[model samples]
Structure formats: C-alpha cells, structure tokens
Target chain A: MGSPAPERIVRFSGTVRLAHWLLASTFFVMLFTGMCLYLPALSRLVGRPTAKAWHLWSAIALLVGIAVLLLIGNRRSLTGVVRDADRLDQDDVAWLKGGPRRLFDHDDAPPQGRLNAGQKLNTMVMLGLMVVLAISGTLLWLGERDTTYRFGGSVLTHDLASLAIGFLVMGHLYLALVHPTTRHALRGMVVGDVDRAWAERNHATWAMSESVQSAERNA
Target chain B: MTANAPTPRPGGRPIGRAAFLGTVATGVGSIALLSRYSGSVQAAIQKVSAAVPGVNQIAPTAGWRIYTVADQMPTFNAATFKLKVSGHVANPVTLSWSEVDALATETQVTDFHCVTGWSVDKVHWEGFRARTLIDLVRPAGNARYVTFVSTEAPYVDQLTLAQFTAPGVMVAKKQDGVALKQEHGAPLRLVVPAMYGYKSVKWVGEIRFDAKRADGYWEQNGYDVDAFIGRSNGLTGS
Candidate 1:
C-alpha cells in the first residue's frame, strides 16, 4: 500500500509566528514584574523600583513591538484575523452553545473559519483589554514622572486590566498546553503550520475554501 | 470522529480532565496560602511597630516617593528651628524644637494617601496632636481656618477649623521610630491622615489660624484647597 500524502499545511505566516512568540515573551515578563508590583510580599523578591522598571520597560517594548509588526510585518494576515474574528456567524453561535466539550470533540464541533469561535472571542476580549491596559498604563507612567498628570481612575483601570488579563492568559495557556485536543494548536503559533489532517478536521470550512482557491489559482 | 483521524499529541503528554482540574486546584490553593502568609506578615510588621516607641504604623520607607514642587529640598539648622503659632489666636507663641517636642505626644497608625495615586498604609506617626497645639493657643471664634507654612520652601496649605482639630491630625516629629529626616521635613512636619500628602506640609515653620480660606502652593496651582482623602481630587470611588 502507498503511504498517505504529507499531512502538512501553512497555518500561520512567519511574521505572525514571530509576533506571537514576541508577545508571549513580553507578556510573561510583564506578568512577573506586574505581580511583584501588585503583591507586597512578592515585591521583596525583586525590589519595588526594579519591578517597576521592568514592568514599565516591558510594557513599552510590547507596545513598540505591536506597532512595528502591524506597520512592517504581515498587515494582511493581521487584518484577516481581525476580520475573521469579527465575522461570527451561525456556526460560531452553534459552537458556543455546544461549549468546551465540542472543542475537545472536534467532529462534534461546527465547521469553523481560519479562527475558531473561542479564538475569535479571545481575540476580541484581549483587544479590548489591551486598549484599556495601554491607556491606563500610559497614564500611570505619566503620573509617575509628573505628579500633576495623575488621574484617580488610572490606578483602578490599570489594576483591574492587569488582573483580568492575567486570568485570561491562564485560561489561554491551559487550553493551548493542557487541553487534550487543543494542545496541538500551540504548534501553529510556534512553527507557523499545522498538520493538514488536523486542520481539515478542526477547521474544515477554512480548509475546503483554501483548497478551492488554490485549485482556481492553479487553473 | 473520522476513521482516519490522527492521534492528537498534547505536547507529547496527554493531560486528562483530572490532571487539568488538579492543576487548577493547586494554583488556587497556592494563591490562598500565599495570601494567608501575607496577612501574617502584615500582622507581624504591625506588632513590631507597636512594640517600638514613637511608632504607630509600619509602612516601609521604600514605598514613599519624595515629591518637591521646585525640584529642590532645603536643609535646616535643627538648633535654630522654631515653630511659630500666630494669627487669630488668644496667645501667639514662638517655640523652639525642644519646646515643641516637650508637648504631650501622640502616636497614630494611619494611611498616607497622595493625590498622585499612590498610598503608604499603616504609617507610624509619633508627635504632638494638632488639637494639643490648637488648645495651647486657643483659636478665636473668628478663626475659621488654619494655615501651615513650610520653613524651607514657599509652600503653604490651610485646613478648616474642624479639619484642623480632627482626631489623628498631628505634627509628627519622628517616623518609623526614628527622628524625621530632612528629606521628610526634618524636626517638624504636619501629618494630616484624612487629607492628601500635599496638605501634610513638610518643614512646618508656622501655623496660622486664619479668618478666611487661604490657598496653599498646590491649591493655587489648580489642586483642590480641601484635599480631603478619598473626597477631593478625583479620588472618590477609587
């Protein structure tokens, strides 16, 4: 019997993968330093000033990296992800109703686009949270330098955003690394590709569309 | 499920529902334990502060930020330092540092909130209560406000009669069980726990009971005159 065809497909572009990893690292640094700043006991491990410096610098780096990637990297792919996330149809609604169990049982899930319902939801939530964090963090930094630039709500916003994002990140990590079925999804972020069979099963609608476009281009 | 479906490798090791639940449980348990430990540490710090004389709070010095309006901190001669209590009072007195220190001392543990969004909690302030000084030079019925003048800088702030005589408001002489440093308004500084740090003027050289409201340095520069804690300066609901 002949061996099956190679089950591999380009799932993410190089720029997307780079941005993903960069953001992941930056997020971890921010999380650690931010925790240090929030919890007084943890502040003893790394002095408050050092933790503050790390948190501020990492936040700046994250913002710069995001801006650079959007400006110079795969703007098309970024826009596509955003557009796809925004376009949640009946299938996404059905998937949401079926809940996390359907996520584990891929065959039970409704056919999805390039991004799944959960991923779309995550993207939107993270986007909103990032905007809040950025604005609040900037206000806090400004207040630190110039006492006159302070706003009372800035602290509340920054603190709430940090905690919410931290919890969201935990859930994100659990699904990407610990969940029985979705753990393989991390590969798409790391190596920029996923097994074609896995993609066909998980994202059948997107895979079928890609195949039709490829054939049309070839013809 | 497809007949030809490939086995999913979860980072090379399969994690079952029990394992996932276990991980989450452990995480939550660790957090709870850490918080409990933190509470114990806080209690211990408070205990230590209470044991030490002239200390009523236990905020770490590292948490405080030195803020100056003109980017300048002035030095003072402790030997020549005098606290002048005048204006709308029955007896106007000019007392030296020794005389001020000789007054009935009070200790209070309170949170020092800054308008700039940072707070130093559980600060041990040991000094003469504002009521003591107010009583020493009983204010005239017309005296509705009290003005604090900083000796080193051109900074000034005022408080209403009620606010000036409120409980826990004092002129602190020592902080964290030691003499107040110059950077922290050495020899004498006002500690208004119920108001923002800006209203707690450092290097207090004079206290004047006034007939009308007087704007301090910060108030003239757009800050609220009544810098009440969690009330003025947009700190409400925060």
Candidate 2:
C-alpha cells in the first residue's frame, strides 16, 4: 500500500487510564475535605461534621477503589507498570543523576522506558504515603471513643502525612500540566495512546521493544 | 459619645470605642492563632481573659474549638444578664443574673468530649442542674421538647425534656472555677456531658419549652440529632 500505513501504538490501556483517574479523583476529594477539616476557619465554612464525613467516606472510596482496580484491572498492565517501576536499569539511574538538566534535556538520559526514574520514585513514595495515611486516619477515627489511638500519636502522623501528600501532589500536577518536556506525556494518561514517534523519542528503550507488547489483552 | 457615657444597662460600664476595638482585635487575633499551638497558647489566652474583660471575639479556648454564626461574638454584661424561660411552660419567668446564680449549684469534674476527636479531661464545670431550671419553670404537660436559643443568632439546639433533665446535664456558667470567656459561650451554655459538644448550645439567651423537637443549626446541616460521643453520626467504634 502507500507507506505501510502508520502503525498505531497504544501507550496505556483503557483499564490503566481508568485506574489512574479513579485514584486521582479520590485523592483530590480527600485533599479538599482534609483541608476543610484541618483549618478551623475552613471547617466553619463547610460544617465540621460534613468535612469529617466527606473525608472519611473518600478515604474509604480510595481503598475500595484500589481493591477493585486490583481485582478487575488488566493483569498484564497492572503487573507490568509495577515491575517496570521497581527495576531501574543503568540508563534510568543515569537519567535520574542528570539532575535539573533532566527536566529539559533528555539527550544525556539513558534510554528511558514507559516511566522514568523520577516517576518510579514518585510512585513508590505515593504508595508509601497512602499506607500511612490509611493507618493514621483509621486510628484517628477510632480515637473518637477510645483515646488509645490518640495517645499513640495518630493525629501527628495523619497531619504530617497530609502535609507531605499535599506537596507531592502539587509537584505531580506541575510535571503533568506545566513541565515543558513532561507535559506532552499527559495525553498518554488521558486518551490511553500516544504517537509511536513520540514514544520512540521519549522512551526509546521501550518503544523499540514495544511491538511485542500489544495494546489489547492479546498477551 | 463620651468615654464615660453610661450604657442602658443599670450597672454596666460604658465600653469606649478604643476599648471595644481593642477587645475585637484581640479576639480576631486569638482566632487567627491556629490550634496547632494549642495547649500553652490557649492557656495563656484564657489567663488573659480571666483577668481582663473577655474578648467578645472567637479564640481557641483550652483546646475547645469555637463555633458560632455571628461574624464576631457579642459580649454579655454578666451584671445585667437574663435567662428567660417561656413557651409551653406553666410558669414563664425572666430570671436576672442574681436570681439565676442563686439557684442550687454544683461543681462536677468531667471530661469534655467533642465529636471531632478531641477531649479535655477533668474540667471542673460549676452550674445548677437543668432539672433545677426545669423545676423552677414548671414546663406544661404538653411540652415534650425544649429549645436552647443562643444570643448568637442562627445558632440554636434542641433537647427532649428527659434529655435536658439527664444526670450530669446542667446550665454551665463557669469552667474550671472561672467564669466562661466569650469564645466559650460566655454567661451561659447548656452542658450535655453525655453528648457531643454541638448539643451544648452556648450563649443561651432563652429557653423555650416546645411540643416537638426542631433540629438545631448543626442538626439541619446533616449532623445527628442524638450526637452521642461514639454511637451517633455513623461512627461504629466506641
């Protein structure tokens, strides 16, 4: 035919995109309600009980959503990302060590795959934050009647975790929306596909070997 | 107009503009001070209020978070303060400060529990029991519920007669042997020790004996009317 018809490559499957958005929405809901609970002035605006209830419910939704995502999500996509994020190659290490220049210049970067070293680190930290937040949040809720949880410093842990996640989310938003080089990658999350050319340029290591990884669940 | 000009109240001191502004500023500043610096700062502010004319502004008091509808808390003249009991009561009476104070009073040490997961332990609250007031008012046979209306408008709560007369319940005027600061619902606030903090209506100006329970401000805003410390509000764990 004309030119071997431009091969369509999918960056992320629909299942992966659904999971990402679900986590993001729940996170934002918790953040909004958490801020209302944290600040007294804000609490007065949106009654404390409302804020407390929303915070609790959203926290529950986040857990349940994660569980459901694990249960029904594409097994290959779920394990593939976690496996890729956990094991960093020499190129990922070198790309991370490239410092601030890595933001604008990917030339010095060792051939990156689906996710870079920075993203891997962010994923790990975010997971850790979720674990602590859930534990501390449960304790604080229980402390309502039994002060034992309060005595164990659940409030402090919850507050610190809140502060950390607040900042981490802001950084994540900046990269996803504002960072010149990384902003282009947001489409991969939004529509679940990206140009193979862009993938080749950004994630050369994965793009070259990506043909074996089909977009559909054929594997 | 003049600094010494007398207010309408018989024994009330005329609060000059400067003093009023100063009080308002202190209250606003105190409210701005976050609860993160709670224990020491709150104690110090309470000490100041104990010695000075209580700032009729909001402030975190002894770990108690203040909630009110008015933009600024209105100060009450204890010398001229009055509690009016009417509605479905057989005896409608407006008791002046002295009359209300003369009723039999008790000081009980109890922990104050807020639904928001904070508790202040062993607070000494001195006040006459709600039963004491109910006895004096003699609510009519038809009156099943009582509404505690706050001086702060749009902020009110309700309690059944039985709930109002519950043991450990009282109309608290003092906390820890000290007259209540404005932010703590000065002059008078209902103390429902068994329930969450919202049930305790602060700055109570009038007590209306009603035939039915009308949800208070918090209740209207989706808060449980019962407001038990652990049992209500969709909470399961004790």
DockQ of 1: 0.06
DockQ of each: 0.06, 0.01
For A117-190, candidate 2 gives per-residue lDDT tens digits of 77766676666667667766776676554533332235544655676677889999999999877787888889
Off by over 4 Å in 2: A1-8, A212-219, B1-238
Q: Name every residue pair that clashes in candidate 2.
A: none
Q: Write the per-residue lDDT of candidate 2 for residues B115-196, one digit (tens) a residue.
A: 6545566788999887787788888898999899999888899999889888898899899889987777888888888898
What docking tier does model 2 reach? Answer: incorrect
Steric overlap count per candidate = 1, 0
Error of 2 at B189 (Å): 6.5
